[model samples]
Target: MRASRFFALRERGTDARTEALGGLATFLTMSYIVFVNPAILSSAGLPFDAVAVATALAAGGFTIIMGLTTNLPFALASGLGINAVVAFDIILGRKVSPDVGMACIVLEGLLAVVLVLAGMREAVVRAVPTSLKLAIGVGIGLFIALVGLRDGGIVVNDPSTGIALGDLSTGPALIALAGILVALGCAAANVRGAILIGIATSTVLGLVFGVLDGPSAVARWPTSGDFSTIGDGLAPGALRDALTWALVPIIFSLFMTDFFDTVGTAYAVTSAGGLLDERGEIPKVRNLLLVDSAAAAGGGAMGVSSVTTYVESGAGVAEGARTGLASVVTGLLFALTIFFVPLIAVVGQGVTVGKDTTLHPAIAPALVMVGYLMIQLVREIEWDRPEDAVPAFLTIAGIPLTFSISAGIGLGVFGYVVTMIARGRVREIHPIMWMLVPMFVAFFASNWLSAHVF
Candidate 1:
């Protein structure tokens, strides 16, 4: 098949229709980023339209590259946690200019590129234990789940209590619950596209039940992006401004967050796709990593935050995508979104309420279901070994609790190493593992100090 030769679908055990559906599924699951990433970055004084354009271009362009070059099913885009860091910590917290913040992101991306090109990235990826990798996948699953729940209005914040059940009487909350039920029902019935179907159904119900206010019209082209601040970030003056002695910790924090967030997303999505080889390594991993780092660097140049692999690609993998064709479809959808921004803006606005929007409960169901699927990795872990199980559990728990992928890995790795040392099995640890302990501690300490002292 022409498709078979291009994406090797036959060899990988998928067909054209299945891969196409998978791509559509993945796009539906993740297209929210087009709006969300721009919204978050705008808080840091970046232009919303420009960030939106850059986000779409970076996501679409590099995801296509990932498909074509690596022939893998992974997709890349502006990351969630990193955007918060760029906005809150790098820009707002440090009182840095937006350009300087972009400088930090650019430097972080360039460092990733150097590491990948030098094979240091692969070395680090290989050094991580399999159990911990699976744990990262599960951890990210719950993190996104928490996000989905918040967005769906199933969960809400209480000034009295940290978080509590949302108001059930609200139209959005009820629609979210209905959407969740539809998705869960479809999955239980073994229906293909169950998640997508649920999203569509919930959207229609949201419209009919007065839960969502409809747009007057659905489609229009997006505004062109402003690349005015693109490469200005890494200029000599900008670097000098960004690199105070006190900010060493800030830079390291950026690098660490970008590095492991990609690692976690890549691990989770690839594992979901069954793209791992017998050794539990994603094939063409070096290519994938290079493409990922290149995407981050390119996003910086294109005027956005860090771009990394999207974990929502698991939606595609769950739908039977086993080749790059799915990624191609996803990239194409992102490209088309440039013209359909008006339509997406209407439908995907979710349920906005006083700056507290519900996860367009329409799509939140997909994430909840995907998280359920990814969490199944827990069963594959060797539970009897305390050294392995403890670290694994910590990693899994930490991802959601800390709301940072790198922090979870750091916690898990630290726990693993300390447990081994206590048990007199320290010799088994990788040398790089030793290097990581202090790095993780530094990331935590730096953030704490910045929050408490400075």
Candidate 2:
């Protein structure tokens, strides 16, 4: 009764046993993040153990908060595309320190919180056309798939062609290919946690082929050094460095992704769970947004990345989880993963085939699999209208080809405005969209502005 009172389980037409099963289902569907997040973030030069710990802490803590505050079955974790931006785009591409890159995430999260408080988050979302928003997800999916291919050694840099097919005969490549097949097979069979299962299978193949080293320890309590990334974004000078003119658009880009992602995930998951209000909107949306916004900042402060609601919560909903009790269960599972750091380390470690070529056979397939999942949004875009199609195409191609999510979004925005003006539909463009034009122009010329104007 106390549990029912706290989570309003009976009102939601759910019981404790159903909530527990739903929580387990959701956790199984998403537990791959525990291995994948650290694998991705560690490439940015963050400590592997630290990121692993931070990732679990953020996911567990935020998901529990989401359950308690909003009484929804939504779960939170370090977002996939957002982490890629923080790791590759901000830190490696821009050549900024990890602290500065993470500080950008913090700023973006805080800005989102401000926008939500001011009731302007929806305004910003409406400013961008639906086609462009959908295209952003598709573009990022290609970008992620590209990264996965490169990491798995199925694709490699070429002297003449820029990139070419890699040596599939290699152990890592073979394992990756096999892993992808296994994942796809499982998915086709409606397997739960297919991606996680693929990673495990690939890791085993890697071990058998001697391409991966086994874990030194099975489990242990993490030490202080394992959490050194905590609060790194707030260290002196990090936030200052992140606030530069050149980085502002990058932060805005992150905010846009996080903002739209939460809205979309919340709507989809709640709708599936029959948890929508009479108006067909998410119940307690403000509370949900607040928790998601705070999680983004919390993830950055913990040195992971932006944390957001996962669409995979639908898996729990499918299992009869209609209340936040399921979320609390998911959070507890994530918390339990902290002790299995050694097993995580084994799968996350990269295998070097050459002086410059490192392969992640165990983890690469999951990236490719996730990309496949995200890319499914492509069907929602209308291709017949050139105005929408052209901009969407530019965005879809720009992200993976140019290696910049923001650049792709800017291209799409610029093209959308230009095409609308060409069609004499200028008045249809939102004032916020108009504001974005100059900002994107500035973003495109940021290096020049930083050099001459600033």
> How well is each residue in 314-342 modelled by candidate 1, as lDDT tens digits?
87888898888999999998887666555
Residue 442 in model 1: shift from native, Å? 1.2
In model 2, how large is the Cα lDDT of residue 429?
86
TM-score of every model? 0.83, 0.92
Clashing pairs in 1: 151-358, 151-359, 152-359
lDDT of 2 by residue, 1-454 (tens): 8989999988888899999999999998888778878888888899999899889989999999999999999999998878988988889889999999999999999998888899777567546676787787788778878888888999999999999999999999999888888998998898888888888889999998898898999999999988999999987799999999878778888986787667656765786688889976678887888899989999999999999998778889999999899999999999999998999999889888898666777888888887787677778789998778988999899888987777887888888998899989999989988988888888888778778887
Cα RMSD for predicted model 1: 3.7
Clash totals for all candidate models: 3, 0
Q: Which candidate is the best by TM-score?
A: 2
Q: CA lDDT, every prediction?
A: 0.76, 0.86
- TM-score, cand. 1: 0.83
Off by over 4 Å in 2: 271-280, 382-390, 422-424
